[model samples]
Target: MSTRLDELVQELGQADRQERIELLIDLARELPPLPDRLAGSRDESHRVPECQSPVFLFVEPAESGRIRLYADAPAEAPTVRGFVALLVAGLDGATPAEVANLPDDILDRSGVREILGMQRISGLYGILRRLRALAAQLPQPESPAKMPADTPSADPPSAASSDPSTAAASTPDPEALIAALRTVTDPELHVNVIDLGLVYGIQTQGHEVHVEMTLTSPACPAGPQMIRDAVAALEKVEGVTKAHVKLVMNPPWSPDRMTDAARDELGIF
Candidate 1:
């Protein structure tokens, strides 16, 4: 069985440009519609927004109507945004509460830098206003969002501790360890770091451990997040300690490094 990320990748490849785009637009429509009650919630301007990127993100209230957002990036722009929108749309049918249940691996499926970049997301609030208006006209409907147990989460106090040397020295639990790290993905690629071949090296001797990793882009926004998440992911290992993480920009990440599964997910064939 593939992870939700795997399902999303396959779906994106199968969708046409227009279909992929509208799918995101619909997700923008799914965020809980903000209300006059949210006066204390926002900065008081209370205006909505649109997604210029293919993916649209919004925080929604558990109850009531819908929140709509859209950002129509030029088809020529970088593609990952569209991919995000596409994936989120498929995930959107679930209630905001349910969607929130998603593990960081599936909901975020992105490297730390990517999640952090969202803090400075640009363009298209106008589209959000339009979607919100559109939702008001439709009959209200709801669904439950359930997070699968295997999903990856992005909570704090990462497995990587204040002391990398100590963390690396602990005994290891490979399955739990890999599960934790699989949650770390290349932000732009929205794919697991493991699949991206970003992990350059791993050396273990008894309890002591060492690790090396790289970014998909030299200036990736998810850098800090990836670093932080990597440490956390590795920290979960029982015998692992001193989980050292090193970042490399040389050689860079290439399509050649992509796993066969990753490639097939992108429909490269």
Candidate 2:
């Protein structure tokens, strides 16, 4: 393990829930300011679209084999900022090979998974994957493209198909759509959104499907990523060609909406 990562794991391991959050915020504050060229709207190419927050990341390779990481996240999204802060600080000055070999489950060891939830953990993985991809430019072994096991595919099936038979065969089933959605978990609550009653409705028209869902809170930072993941999950079904998600605030979510199984898992009376 890298020294910095080891130290981070130790620090996180010792902190309680609230203290861990405070430590993350402190790390966010410590993230060095990005150079003007890489800040603001200038670095669109470096943006991590997989992140719920509008996070931009860039990797700079040094002659000495070490690489420098630059990242920017909104202050409103402190959790993401902190996550990027952790990566920037921990991986700074590490060689491209070192980063490429970094453990896939490093975040799990950091104890952040218990606090930040799976969505944020998955976003962290997205950052690492992008970082490694950038670093691979430095003459690394060729590896087949692979999506993170915990993340949904970023590329959905193309809506435009040349064959009508193919398009018709790709029509999604409502039952299958709901089943695929059951695989998505609420980041904060750690419960499947279906069981939590976050899914308001599902509709399918030929090869296109639409879903209506709500977040536990109107201000949930993970909302965008969740929607993206939902779309991706739907698109992965054998017959889905297009997936559309609509966020609904009306008929707002409540604990009362959760299934008895969810309540049991959460220890709610």
Candidate 3:
């Protein structure tokens, strides 16, 4: 581990859940403003698609073989912004080899994983993955024997139906759709949103499917990603040609919305 990362882990290790959250907010506030060149640019290439927040990042080799990271996350998404800030503080100024050798479970050692949730932690992993990829582009010493386990696979498992007979079916199976939706998880909570009671309703007309859902918070950084995942999950269902997700905040979300299983996992007795 980098010295900075080790220090951070030790600092955060002493805090309780709520204190960890406060520290994250403080880190978010301390995040440096983006450089003018990359700020507000619409270059899709820099965007981290895995993040639900509109986060964009880039890494470049700096003087003395150091690496510099630049990132932008919306102010509304403090959790995401804080995470970005954490990465910047931890890995900035580190050598390429140090970055490339970062352990996949680095975040797990931070002592804030439970408070940050699985989704946010997962997005943090995505940021690290991008950083490593950028670092790999520059000339370096012999690569590590093993890559980080959390690095996303190039070939995602196919969700398409294997049976050709079911491929053209026009009716979307409600059960199958539900099952597919179940596959989409809340990265932070490590629980399916369905079990969290995020899905308010699901409907299908012809081959188009519509889903109504809400997030744990209106300002959830993972909101957009969750919505996209929901749509993608639905589209993978047999007979669903299109998928639409409507995010609702009228009723809001509360612990009561969670299913017994979710509550059990979260120890919400």
Best by TM-score: 3
lDDT of 2 by residue, 1-269 (tens): 46896788678768888998898899889989888876765354576656777788777877666787788888887767887888788888777767756665667766778888865576776666666555544543333222222233345535444356666666666668878888888888888778887885666655666677789889999999889889899989877777777887744455545745323322100
RMSD of each: 16.1, 14.7, 15.2
lDDT of each: 0.46, 0.70, 0.69
Model 2: clashing residue pairs?
A: none
* TM per candidate: 0.33, 0.50, 0.50
Candidate 2, which segments miss by more than 4 Å at Cα? Answer: 40-43, 139-269
lDDT of 3 by residue, 1-269 (tens): 57997687667667787787788789889988888886867465676656677788777778877888777888898877877787788888887777766666656666657777766676666666656655545555443322223323343322343344544465688778888888989888988987887875565545656676788888889988998899899889878777777787734455544645322322100
Pick by TM-score: 1 or 2, better one: 2
lDDT of 2 at 75: 84
Runs of candidate 3 with Cα error greater than 4 angstroms are: 40-42, 141-269
Model 1 Cα lDDT, one tens digit per residue, 88-166 = 4544443432332333343233222243255543332232222332232233355221221222334333445445676
Residue-pair clashes per candidate, as listed? 32, 0, 5
lDDT of model 1 at position 85: 51
